[model samples]
Each structure stands twice: as C-alpha cells, then as structure tokens.
Target chain A: MNESAISIKDAALDYPRKKKGVGLLREFITGRFKKIPRKDRWFRALNGINLEVKRGEVVGIMGPNGSGKSTLLRVIAGIYAPDEGSVEVEGRITLLAGIGTGFNQDLTGRENIKLTGSIFGFDSNSISDMEEGIIDFSGIREFIDDPIRTYSAGMRARLGFAIISNLEPDILLLDEVMSVGDYEFRKKSRARIDELVQGDATVVIVSHSKSILQSMCDKVYGIHNGEIVTDGEPDSAFEFYESEKE
Target chain B: MGVSENKVLRRDGKLPFLSAPVKIMQNLYNYRQLLKHFIGRDLKVRYHNSILGYGWSVLEPLALTVTFYILFAILSDSEDPYRPLTILLGILAWSLFAKTFSNGTTCIQRNSSLIQRVYFPREIFLFSKSGYNMFHFILSLLVIIPLLINYELMPTQQLILLPIALIMILMLGTGLAFFTSILQTKARDVEHIVTIGLRISFYLSPVFYPLEMITGGRIPEQYAEAYLIANPMATYITMIRSAFTGAPLDIPTMNLVITFATTIAIFWIGSIYFMRKERKAVKFI
Candidate 1:
C-alpha cells in the first residue's frame, strides 16, 4: 500500500454560467417560439492540476484570489467533482474554512456545536464528551446557552475553531482559518494545529499568507492561473510565488 | 504510488440510474444524525420566541377547519353528522402535503450556506425540512383526538388505514419536492411556478369542501370517477376521512390502487431525477 492520504490525477473542473434560469428559459423560448440558437458560457476553475499528500505530511496551497484555490480544495473534499481525471481521498476528512463553517445562527451555541459536530461525522456520545472542552476553549461561557445569532463574529469564530480543532480526523482541510482570530487566539490555534500535525494527522491548508505557510507546512505548492507553478520547500516556493506576483 | 489502490472516496460524474435509489437510501442512513439535527433546528427556529410556540401547530389547522365549516354551513342544510369531521380530516391531510411540498422545494436554496461547507446527502436538506412539518402534523393530531372523542367517532378496524394515508401523503409530498428542489436550484422561477400550481391544486382538490360536491351533482356523471383518480390529493383525503370517521369510502377501490401506485412511481422517479441533478447542481449554487 502507498499509504497516501490524498491523490489527484490530472483533475480539472469548470462551472457553467449560462445554464441557470434566465439563460435556460431564454433558450427554451427561443428554440420553441423564435427559432434562434443560443450558446452557453463556461468558466474553467481548475485546469489539469495534479497533486498528492502522503499520510502524515502538512501541505500548504497558495494562490491569488480567483485562481481556483478554493475550487481545488472543494474538489479534493468531494464537494465538487472534477470535470477531468480523478481524486481519491482516504481516511475521515473535515474541511474547516472561515468562521462558523456549519453553524446555524438561530441555534444556541451548545446546539450549534452538536449540529456541526454531527455534520462532521461525530457520534452523539463523542459530541457529548467534547462538550465541556469545546465550551471552555471557546471561552464564551455566558453565551454558550444563547442563540448563535447573538454572538459576535469573533465569538462565533472562536467557537468554530475550538470545536474543529478538537476533532481527531485523519485528514484536515483548512481554508484560511488562521486569518479570523485575534493575536492570542491565533497563537492558541497554531499550537493546537501543531499538536494535530505532531499526532500524524495529514493536513492541507490554503492561505494567502506566505509566513503562515512557511511556518507550518513541510511542503508548499504555489498555484497560479489554475495550475501549480511552484512545488518545493516552503522558502523556495514562497520565493517563486513572490517573484511571479511582482 | 500504487496506481490501482482502492480510494476511499471518488467523485465520478453522474452515477448510473440503476444505483440512484439505493445510493439515496445509503446516504440517508449514513447522514441520519445530521438529519435529526436539522429537524431539531427547524422546529426550534420556527417556534422560538413565539407566544404560543408549539400551540400554533395545532391551532393553525383547527382554525382553518372552523373557517371552512362556517363557509360550508351556508352551502346546504343537509344535517349530515360527519361533515365537520370530514372537513377537519381533509384540511389536516392536505396541509401535510402542501407544507411539505412548499418547504421541500425551497429547502436546498435555503441551505445554500451549508451546501458549500459540507458534503452530505443533499436530500437531507429536503427531508429535514419536511420531517419537522411531519412532526407538526403528528402533534396536531393530538388536538383532534378530543374532537374525535367529542363526536363519538370511535375507532373501527379501518382505523389501521390512518397511518397508511399519512405515509402516502409524505411519499407524495417528498416525491414532488425532490423534483422541484432540483429545478429550483437552477432556476428561481420554479418557486413561483410551484406556489401558483399548489394554490390551484388546493382549489381543484376537495380540501375545503366535501368530495360529494363534485361526485354527487356538479360535474357530469361519467367524468366524476376520472376526476377523483386524476387528483390524488382528493383520493388521499377521502381515504383518511374514511379511516377516521368510519364513513363509506366514496372513492372507488381502483382509484385507491392507482393513487398508491402513482405515489410510489413519483417517489422513485423523483429520486432518480434528484440524484442526477444534485451532482451538477452544487456548482451552480
């Protein structure tokens, strides 16, 4: 067995812009009534991108906005299917993006924790066991019983990070998660992530921060125009990305 | 790297139609906990901060029943004993269908935020929204138990049919929902179309009035049976009413058979359509 945590072979994904209501309706009416032909518009988000992560490696992906970073992550998470090639992921996985990735605003903080935990494939007993730790880490004791809509953005992000960081998934996909918190919380989050990586959890993170990538990732891949342009150690990849940006 | 190793997860485009039904069931079972959470979220959000809370679930149908009773009171002074009970039964049965359909159609769009964040069975969104409505339907039945007792409508062997009728409504509502929710994901106009269609369906079916009004005299004799078979809601309401009040079923036996078959067909077809559409639909969202 190769013991690979993630694998992508020549993956490509595109989205259709002209297949929605107005476009479809216009085409239908034209074809049936007006006898006209219509063309469809397409946007290719990921193009022939191939990468793999071994069982215990921490890899960071960096790219400019709209360069398909999130799209690639989504593809690997099985949330979006690649238009070409294939993606294979082994082990339990969770994608943690911005604050409140799966929290319901109307639910109490406690309720939201249970809900998000279940959605992440945690059993009820596991969620119950982690309840006190999550609440304590979030430090939102007063509002833990209040609806999530009442919490501040910082509070919500704190709660979200706390719960996600506690989960012991074999694979973790993080999308710019460290950008949300204050300095102290970010430090705590970094420590928690370091602990997970130390415990042999495979991690893939996407971030715009070169410093963050250089600090945490064993290998870094720089993406440009929907393809990986640089792959190597953190310093070399960051250097290549910086020169390309200039 | 081993090229032929078994991958734990793979996203091949478009599953085979033969596997769609089984796949949907598998996803439902795997995501049952998420479905339960969503149901709880729905019920809590709906009743939170309301003065009456869960009482509104019972009161809404009861109030509608009273309004229709008053309106129908003017139509004829026939002195039929089961009129009010039948009317209540019809309203309750039809609302279950209507609420589930309306909520299920828009549920995917409503959970667009969650869709982008996680990958579970998308149908869980549809089921959870309808599931709470089903819960409300069950709770409302409690209110009617007193009414059933007050009217001395004791249980008969036919009472076994009550659960069957309710299950039929759930299947039919969910089937229509799966179809509409997929369409609404691509086109917002489907929502408006569904709303208008449902309203017209309410009028065409025997929700506010008795089935006798149509079968007895209004329409020509030959078309009456066709009309009942054409509108499954009317047949469903009649069955539920017959089960509860022990009234003779005005609906033909063949009509019941056709309705059941049609409900199953729609559910199967809807599952097929939804699974195919769901894979491509996430990108649009």
Candidate 2:
C-alpha cells in the first residue's frame, strides 16, 4: 500500500449545462433523454486530469468555481466513475468533503455516530469505541444524546469533522478547508489538519485562500476551465493563478 | 500504481462500471445498518413533535380501537357475534400493512439527502420505514388488553399461538414493504399507484369479514381453498381471529404452504432488485 499509494491517469468529468439556443418546449422534450444532443452532453468538467501523489505527501488544489477541483476530488474518492480513465488508490481512502451531510437529523448524536460510521464502512463495535473519541474531540458532550437536528451549524460541522477524522484514512481529501466552520472552529480544523498531515497520511486540500495555499501546501495546481493550467511549487502555481486574474 | 499506460487500452467494448454481484453482497450488509439508522431516526422524531413523547405509541392505537369499538357496535345493523374481535384485529393489522406500504413506497425519495450524497444500499430506507411502523404496530396491539376483556373476546389456551402468528404477520408486512419500496424507487408514479394498491389490498385480504362469511360456504370448496391460499392474510386472520373468538382454528395445510413460499420469495427477489437499484437511488435524488 505504501509503495503503490494513490495515482490517477487521464481521468475526466463532463456535465450537461442547458444552453438557451432552442425553443423551451422543444428543448424540454429532448432534454428528457440524453439532452443537448450527443455532441454537447459534455461540458468537460475535468479534462484528462492526471496526477500521482506518493505516500505522505500533502497535495493542494487551488482553483476558482467550476474549475473541476471538487469534481477531481470526487473522482479520487470513487464517488463518481471516470469516463476516460482510471484511478488506483492503493490504501483505504476517506473524503472529508462533507460535514454532517450523512447524519440523520432524527437520530441522536450517539446513534448518528454509529449509523454514519457504519454507512462509511466501519462495524458497530468499532463505532462504539470511536464514539468516545468523536464526542471528546467535538466538545459537544452534553448534547451527544440529543438529535442532530437540534444542533446548530457549528455543532453539526464539529460532529461531521470529528467522524471524518476518526476514520484516519491513508488518503485524506479536504475541500474548501477555510469554509468548514465558524472562525473559532475553523481554527480547530486547521490544527487537526496539521496534526493529520504529520502522520503517514496523504492530504489534498482544495482552497481559494492564498494564505492557506502558501502556508500548508508544498505542491499546488492552479486550474481553470476544467484543466490544470499550471502545476508546480506552491509559489509558482500562485504566480500563474494571479496572472490569470488579469 | 497501475502500468501499461500506453498499450493497455485494448478493449473493443466497455463493460458496466461496477460488478453487479459484488455490489449486491456489499449492499446486503450495508442495508442492514441503514435500516437501523433510518428507523431509529424516525421513531425518535415521531414523538418529538408530540407532548406525549412516546406514550403516543400506546395511546394512538388504543384510541383507534376504542373509536372502532363504539362505531361498529352502533352502526352495523347485523353485527356478527364475533364482530368485536373481528374489527379489533382487522383494523390493527390493516393499519400496520397500510402504514408500512404507503410510507415505505416513498422512503427512498424522502431520504434523498442521506441517499443522494453517499453511496449506500437503498433498501435500508425502505426497511427503516417498515421497521418504524412495526414498532408502532406492536405497541398498538397492547391496547387489546381491556378491549379484549370487556368484550369477553379473551382467548383460551390457543391464544399462546398469538405470538407466533404476529411474527409471521410481521414477516409478511416486511416482504410486501421491501418489494414495493424497490419498485417505487424506479418510478415516481409508483408511489401514487401503491397508495391505491394498499387500499385494494386491504379489501382483497380477509381484513373486515371472515372469508367463510364473505362468500358463504356456498362457493365450491376448491375455489375457496385457492382463494385462501392466494391470500396469506385470509388464513392468517382466520386462525388468529378465533384466538379472540375462543374457538379451535382448523388451520389448512395449503394456506401455511402459500404463506411460507410467498414470504421467502418476496424477500429473495426484493433484496436482489433493491440491491441492484440501491446505488442509483441517491443519484436520481
């Protein structure tokens, strides 16, 4: 698993976006099938995305909206199938891309922890053991027995983040790291990310904040129009990103 | 980690993305947990809105029994001697089937947030809905305490068979629920169609009247037996209803055979179909 690590070759994503060229009714009827005709189904959300991240290397992705960043993240996580190529993840992978999104609002925090852990592939006994660690980290002990719907956004995010961290994946994927929680909780998340990267874990962070890009990531890819327009050292990627803004 | 970067793309035709068999095996275990989580959430949430918390589990069913007791006693001109026990089991059993059927059909769509984002075995949602309703259905039957005694519908030693019969009914409800839930996931219109189907199923089953009384023994014996075989509940209710009537149930061998076969077949087919489509349930949502 260590030598094999994670690699992607020629991976691509395409999503159909409706163009307003035709009459609404005629377009609507055809839209029910393949839509936009066979020639135009592809928006080419990610164009031949290729990369190799060795064990324990921290990889960061910096991009604007619709730059195919999250699409690439999902591809690596195996949530979406690649149309053009394949991804080989040697070890177990976990994506911390969502916060409490899989949590059931009707379930208590304790129940949700077990249910969510199982949903992501852990067994029941492990969930019970991990429950304490999850609860301790989130600092929401008193309300752990309460339903998640009662929790505020910060509280829910803490729980979601805590569960993802408990997974301890060899390949850890993060999206919009700065946007996780309130400023106070975001500080906690940053510390956790730093601690996780210190281990043998490989991390890929997707963020638009230049400060984070400069401080955390050694390697970065500046992407636009669904392609990696620049790939190199962090400073170099940012230099290309800045020039693109003009 | 993978090699042959330049020469390995030799396939003439593309295959389906995920292996069908492996996915089914994985989903079988996955759906069990999903069933637990979804049902747990529903059971907890249902009482959260009520001041009674969970006593509504007992209170709601008891109230329904009382209302029916009064209505059936006064409204019907020609009430059968066993009418009290008849309405009691009939209404409770029908409610269980109806609730499980109607709600299970809509479960995959209802939990789009949970299903759409993550990959999970889809039948978990269906099983959860059925599991939650079964909890309520069981709690509701406890209301039969006074209702049974006041009407002198209290049973003989044959009443000990009540627990076994109830378990069978639960299995039947689960089988029907699992089958219908998977069907409805593919077709949005199936939800509406199922609601109507449940109502018709209630009439078709020997819920309200005894099968013997419904047709009168005038119908040929083989046809009546076949009808009973086709309807598991017809046999189910006929035997169990007499638990209240305090009479010996001449259980039919053929009826039991049909009940056993239907239960196993539905579970097997329902699980396979549900597993196949389970991955895509979230995608559609």
User: Best by TM-score, which number?
Assistant: 1
Indicate the residue-level lDDT of A124 in model 1.
83
Candidate 1 residue lDDT tens string, A1-114 = 667889999988877655444435445456467643332446777888889899999999987787888888888888887878889888777777775656777889999888
- Report DockQ per prediction, comma-separated: 0.43, 0.17
TM-score of only chain B in every candidate structure: 0.91, 0.74
Which lDDT value does model 1 have at B222? Answer: 71
Total clashing residue pairs per candidate? Answer: 0, 0
lDDT of 2 at A134: 91
Q: Superposing every Cα of model 1 onto the true structure, what RMSD results?
A: 3.7
Off by over 4 Å in 2: A5-54, A62-64, A75-93, A98-118, A121-150, A209-246, B1-41, B45-51, B74-82, B116-118, B145-193, B217-267
Q: lDDT tens string, model 1, B44-142?
A: 887786658867766777888888788879877656577777777788888899989989999887777778776667888888877888887776677
Poorest 10 consecutive residues by lDDT, candidate 1 chain A: A19-28
Candidate 2 per-residue lDDT over residues B112-190, each given as its tens digit: 6555344444555655666788787666667667767777664588776566566566666665666556545445566
